[model samples]
Target: MAVHHPATIVPTKLELLQAWVPHQPWLGGADVSTVTRLGSYRFDDPDGEVGMETHLLSTDDGRVLQVPLTYRGAPRVGAEGSLITTMTHTTLGNRWIYDGCHDPVYVTALVRAILTGGRHADLYAATDGGLVLEPATTHVRGSGSWSSADVPALTAPVVSHHGTTTTIHAGVRLTLPRVLVATTPAADASLSGTWPGQETPVVLATVDGSS
Candidate 1:
């Protein structure tokens, strides 16, 4: 529930990790770019328009990045995964925190609210966490998908050792797990948890790498 009103702006999550620590790939080289807070939560979105956040960053080498810092008073357009910036104010007016999950309408409303067990923010307790608390369960979409999980065709069904048993071709027979992706007029379906009496998830082709 931070994000006061836009008196001014700039990256505030430690200046966006000093401009995102040389583009982060787990970051390397010994230097001094510390960001130690370790705990934070909250994301309320009723009428107060809250999104207050904090996670912490810059552990270097070992890499534990969650590095969040939100304070929305505006910007819930299309959220997804999160990470936005525009906040910075000091003359005592405060307000301007952008980056609300890159805004794909708040990442499909936090991926349809984690597939239905929604409750965003699990940075683990530390004063029970902070920021303002939002995803207290709203259906955070969960067929285990941040976009259908790790994308090598949504992970699962593999049996390789020259046996050549890499799965997800899903032409369909029947099982307990289904994630079909071979389209023409919408054939394959069933992502478990009752989401597939058919709702349109029939994308055909492309699993060249494996999720």
Candidate 2:
């Protein structure tokens, strides 16, 4: 069964956003005055420790942006495959939570859900054999890359002061916490350097899982 995490105690989506939004890089800042749910998706982890939620947010304009996060109570042992590294310190100590989605099993399940038309995607599995997530409110689809159980590609780029253009190369140091570069033919990697104030993808994508 899918498990629910502490976040479920949140009485409203806004409350949850208020608590979790500032911690994420894509959420803009602690001063965010407004947030409207554009669209969202959930995934069930077979192991059940980490809850994954994919949310799309935007300003008053219709331009939508995506934020995929893995909510974990704690971190894993020697979590080398993690993408975004972040931790919150509670009164007890540090509540270890990073993007563990690169774990092969985690990636596999995400791929499966995308391929199958499952009715519910609310599920999470931790590396320590713990599971949590609300099991009844979500489903998932669209599996394209299942054979290559490789780590998600990582690109290093720094957003311009205006947050439009990004400089990229092989070893450039990046200031962002995590950038999910989608690998495929369906991903629109068509970036624009000539234009300012344009929407550059924080999550670079592939169209057909091609490199």
On residues 54-158, what C-alpha lDDT tens digit does candidate 2 reach at each position? Answer: 554544433444445565656666664444544442322334443423343334444343333222354554334566443332223342433333424433221
TM-score for candidate 2, please give it: 0.43
Task: Go through the candidates in order and give the clash count of each.
Answer: 43, 34
TM-score of each: 0.24, 0.43
Q: What is the TM-score of candidate 1? A: 0.24
Identify the candidate with maximal lDDT: 2
Clashes of 2: 34
Residue-level lDDT of model 1, residues 144-189, one tens digit each, is 3334342221221221111111122222111211112224332122
Badly placed stretches (over 4 Å) of model 1 are 1-8, 16-44, 54-58, 65-93, 96-116, 119-211
